[model samples]
Target: MSINIINRSGHPLPAYQTAHAAGMDVYAHLPAEPVTLGPLQRALIPTGLFLEIPEGYEAQVRPRSGLAYRHGIGIVNSPGTIDADYRGELKVLLVNLSDTDFVVQDGERIAQLVVARHERVAWQAAEELSETQRGAGGYGSTGTK
Candidate 1:
């Protein structure tokens, strides 16, 4: 499936690094200067790109595991969604969870974009519902061991 995009970020288009990669690495569109995120601070970093996703599909913005594990940087929303009908710039909300400051350079791989097909649910109100063996069990209802 192909999607339309308008890029003004002066960086290469988002692409999968290897075969069978589900997400495409997205880059920071900052200029020569880098943005610094202080401890516990968050910033909205623009990608300078707009997308046009097809119907019945949505684009998801996710945090990079390497960045989160190495630099303690992650997206404010783990899986930010871009609606299929929405036409707007793609930006990332990054937060620095570590005590030290983290610098985000231009063209740095900040997040990833994954386009997926989704289905809308139709609500059918009813008085009774089917039951299961573990029905209505809250968190940790099943033993850890």
Candidate 2:
């Protein structure tokens, strides 16, 4: 499925690097000055891009593994959803989890955008939910070594 996009960043459009890559890398559309994030600081970085996702589909913003692993940088709300009806600029909520400062540069790869199809569920209220062998078991109920 093709998506309609408006890119005002003057940078290349987000594209998948590999054939089977599920997400496309998104870049930062910052000004000349670099933005600094102190330890445990968070910032909303813009992409200067607007997308028109098709109905029944959504765009998800996720953190890049390299940034999270090497610089301790990640999206505060990983897998943030961009509704199909939203028509605003795409922004990333980035947070620095390290003790040092991190700099954000213009056109820098900040996050990944994954477009996925989702289903809507209707309420089917029932008196009681069915029971199972592991019913009501949650939060490490399965156990770990």
Candidate 3:
């Protein structure tokens, strides 16, 4: 699947560092000094990127596990969906989950972008669904007690 993308930022295009990686590292586009996020602070970090996604697909903005583990930084809306028709610049909603300040620098790999194919469902208007052995069980019902 070839996607048409326009990168307006100073950094290079997002790419996967290794083979078989599920997502590409998305960079932070900051022209000036780094932005500081205090404890529990949230900010929208722009990527200056626009995409022409094909129909029946979506781009998901997800948190970088390394950042989340090292600095306690993560995307507020992890796996944020970018619909196929959305043409605006890509921005990530980042949150500082740690007690200390987290600095967001230019060209920082703040998040990951995963392009995936999804299906559109049509409701059958049925009042009943097939039951299973653990039907209607939710939350921790299937987990170890």
Find the candidate with the highest lDDT and give its number: 2
Off by over 4 Å in 3: none
Highest TM-score against the true fold, candidate: 3
* Cα displacement (Å) at residue 126, model 3: 1.9
What lDDT does the true structure give each of the candidates?
0.94, 0.95, 0.93
- Residue-level error in angstroms, candidate 3, position 48: 1.0
The C-alpha stretches of model 2 lying farther than 4 A from their native spots are none
RMSD of each: 1.2, 1.1, 0.9
Cα lDDT tens digits, model 1, 67-110, are 99999999998799999888889999999999999999999999
Residue-level lDDT of model 3, residues 23-94, one tens digit each, is 999999998778999999999999989999899999999999999999999888888999999999999999
Residue 49, model 1: Cα distance from true site in angstroms: 1.1
lDDT of 2 at 102: 99
- TM-score per model over all chains: 0.95, 0.96, 0.96
